[model samples]
Target: MGNSLSDGLTDAVRRFQWFYTCHVRVPHELVEHSALSLTEMRVLFAVMHGGACTAADISRTLGLDTGYLSRMLTQFERSGLIERRPCSGDARSTQVSLTAAGETGLSAASAHVRDDVSTTLDAMTPGERAQLIASMGYVQRLLSPPADAPQVRLRGPRPGDFGWIVEREAQLAPGGTHTQRERETRTAMVVADYLTAPDPLRNGCWIAEQDGVSVGASLLVDGSAGSARLAALFVEPGVRRSSIARRLIKACVAFATESGYGRVVCATDLNPVSVAPFLRPFGFEELSNQGEWEKHLKEPRAF
Candidate 1:
């Protein structure tokens, strides 16, 4: 399977290379072209849109070799294609911008690719465009893994995300030989049922994905007569301190409140980490019982 995946990816890249190269790599195709190499045009484009960009910014965003970009900038400056000035705060580096000539060049280069893409897209049917976008999006996510802070966003369930929610929570329940697999399995089933049920009280079922990968989930289900329940809040252990769980709970509670629930309830395990100290900030108060927590709200919050 691994070898097949590798082969498939290689073939896909090979197939995409010709189209990208013909449009981007060959600058001579444009009537009023910059006559720049592919990488140079990319650098120019970066500068054209880069209002306050440094050399390092261009290199990082474009994934260009440092030495190569420096040489290109020097050549562009000599040709009066771009204006470079030392940064005010950091004299060690320089900021870049496209001069009038550079803007004309960027316009030409952009037009060449833009028209080609428009024509190709216009020729394709809607279904074909969707498939192509999905495929290209897959490739884009694969190539550009998250580099900055891992952003965890809560979105309603897409296809197969419910399964991810189940799988991710199941893998985290085991500790040692005395693992409580049965309890975790039951919990997953209950959550899955709640996810698919068509009750209006079911406020929302949100899955949290970190950098395009599902890492956590939370469910807001019908709890009591006039309240909502926050259920199945979990984040992968490897990604714990990222505040994904907090965001998920917050989003779920907001939805419940906005959906006209007077109060929200949650059940936690008998541990400080689970219920006692963990949910203090979101205005949850521990009940007189063992592991039950509740919050009362006057106004519903918008998600």
Candidate 2:
């Protein structure tokens, strides 16, 4: 019986490994480019996304070894793909920005990768595609970066952001996830409403980044002079733990307080599985037990 149990456990481990390889890992071999290596592609992506960055910052963002990054930097510099300049505040530090050639190369490569992924995804049935995407989403949330991970941020929602926010809300609602067509049209209308709103605080949203990718979002919705509600707080699965949710929460609270709201409130449909722990540390109390949980933020707390 012991031998049989051991065999069963071993088989389970092997299957798990196989599943991880098949579903979770992107095959880097498929990303082959004649002009750029994989490391170069990653560096270029980081520089392009951040607008301006330094070698040290790039290493931190990608969690890459500095030695390896230096080599890549040298190659990119030689190719005239990036320019390095002295950091304004620090003479010893250098800042890197993309050259026009670098930008064009990165864009072309991005388009190629997207086309390849789309082609492959197109081969699946709609239901199969949905399941694959949902499963990946679940894994993404599970593997989200830790709270103290480096974050990149922008101040608030820009002109085309309402649509992005709507799409985010729909994606996060599980069963209520919207289709691409629904996302495009309905999100456009939602954006229009936000755009027309008189108050800046009423129609604003923030996206949190980890490893140079947008991982989660929070929104400040209409409220009276000194109060606002935190709405549509959602984080992508793989990057959930990295304190992005907390940062987003704090952003909403700060926005409320600065915009003349004395306090901010948040409501969560309590799921023992996913909702409670993140709130407890931020002065969130067990306001009710009827399957809904609420928290009010009156002051900032160190996260």
Candidate 3:
């Protein structure tokens, strides 16, 4: 049984490797036409994004041999694609940067690669695209070191995000008190209300993204005359306790304050214990034993 399971796992891994190499990698013909080999393009990308980069920096970032990378840099210089200068502080090292010509070349090459990739992605259904992105993120987290973890960013909702919000909220909803169907229905109502809101500037939704995949979400909409209701706040189980929830809440509250809301209130189905840690630090006071929490913001707290 052990051998059988091991063989199955190995086969799965092999299949994934084949699919990745065949389907995920940029086609060789495209790279050939871009005037930059794949490795050269990667080196250029490293230099483009790595401000004040040295030859050593590119080597370390791309895991290329120092001798090989130096040869590439020399070729790039000959082509007038990059400029290198001795570091002022450390004369032994050289600073590398893309010249205008280099930037133009790299941008053009990048555009071609992006267009090619986009064609493939455009063929996928919305759900398939989301799943593929989420799966890639999961694989990256499993394989990458902690220091290399992708930064979480907060952004306004995009197309198909509202549906995802409802689904995720329902899936992550605290169990035992409400059925999944009940939670889903409630979340759908909240999303619908936000969608039909009259004043777009007065209400907001923030989606927390890590590596371009949504992991958490929060909603702030009109409550009373001068209050905003914070609802549908949830984080993915895999990313909970990592300050994503806090960041989402901060964004919502900041938007609320900017929109001239006097206070922000949250009515959660979660018990107080589950919600307190996320709310109390933000000056939210429990308004009831049930899950009502509010924070009166006379001024925005420095986040």
Candidate 4:
């Protein structure tokens, strides 16, 4: 029994090592092919990703030592790969953009990196690919710094959840309003209408479950055959800080993408107090206010 236990622990460690190394070996391969120093390649990649970013932003994203990043920036300038200009918003900050030469060189470096990484991944069988994804998800959860619970599953609604959702309308409304109770009633009716619609694609709602309880919810309504709008989103009180709202929005985006909609939109009566921060991270941009917000959803993999 003791030998069996030891073997199991060894297997776990091996799986972890595999998970941590996924897609990470490509960078080292690219450094060799790009004929650029590792630091130079890293800075170039950062500029490529951020699109007119600053040294400080890159430093923060990569967790590089600030002085070292400064040296790298100077070297890149000397190499004519990047240019920095004074930031319009802040005099103390400098904005950086890539030159045409830099973009072409980085594109070549990226192609080499992708080829190397694909070769490594292709060695695995289909079963291995599935297992690797599962194991990586485990590692993500394990290494993620503790926070409010995250939502990872999406499923059909249950029988009693509708009433609980109705109750939520009252709880989510702002304080100090003569019309607070009336607004809650109206909101509940709108939600019920959405839930009872015959077609799931036409009108659907998802509840975000965290730690075995629903913390947030969203409703999606078909604007046309090809487009849908995210109607309502709310997170339970006290759980807002954990990023539950973002997870809920992600679920809606995933659903819309899988359901074959061209795009998804969200409208709120005034900008939703809880959703702006969440939606922004998922590439949802504000198109117009119009006494409500309009945000477009892209594919889930984009997140």
Error of 3 at 21 (Å): 1.2
What Cα-based lDDT does every candidate model obtain? 0.71, 0.65, 0.81, 0.70
Best by lDDT: 3
Off by over 4 Å in 3: 1-17, 24-52, 64-84, 97-159, 172-182, 195-203, 208-215, 222-228, 235-244, 254-263, 268-275, 296-303
lDDT of 1 by residue, 1-303 (tens): 469889998888888887777755445454346466756766877887887689899998898889988988999999999888999988899989888887876776677667877887999998798667756654665566554576667788777666666655556654642344553675676676685667745557888766566667877787666788776677655565347767887887788767877888887632335544556788889887557788886654433
The C-alpha stretches of model 2 lying farther than 4 A from their native spots are: 1-148, 176-193, 224-226, 240-242, 269-273, 289-303
Superposed by TM-score, candidate 1 places the C-alpha of residue 278 at a distance from the truth, in angstroms, of 8.3
Residue 242 in model 1: shift from native, Å? 3.6
Clashes of 3: 0
Over the stretch 1-303, how does candidate 3's per-residue lDDT look in tens digits?
Answer: 469889998899899888977875654644866867888888888899997799987987778999999999999999999999999989899999999999998777667768878999999998899788888887776555554455788898998899988887777776754677788998899888888888767789998987777878888888776888986788776554448878888898888888777799888664456767988888899876666888897743332
Off by over 4 Å in 1: 1-34, 63-65, 125-142, 145-202, 205-218, 224-241, 255-303
The TM-scores of all predictions, comma-separated, are 0.57, 0.44, 0.59, 0.44
lDDT of 4 by residue, 195-274 (tens): 66667555677876654556667777766547777766676654443466666677777778777666777666423655
In TM-score terms, which candidate is top? 3
By how many angstroms RMSD does model 3 differ from the true structure?
Answer: 6.8
lDDT of 4: 0.70
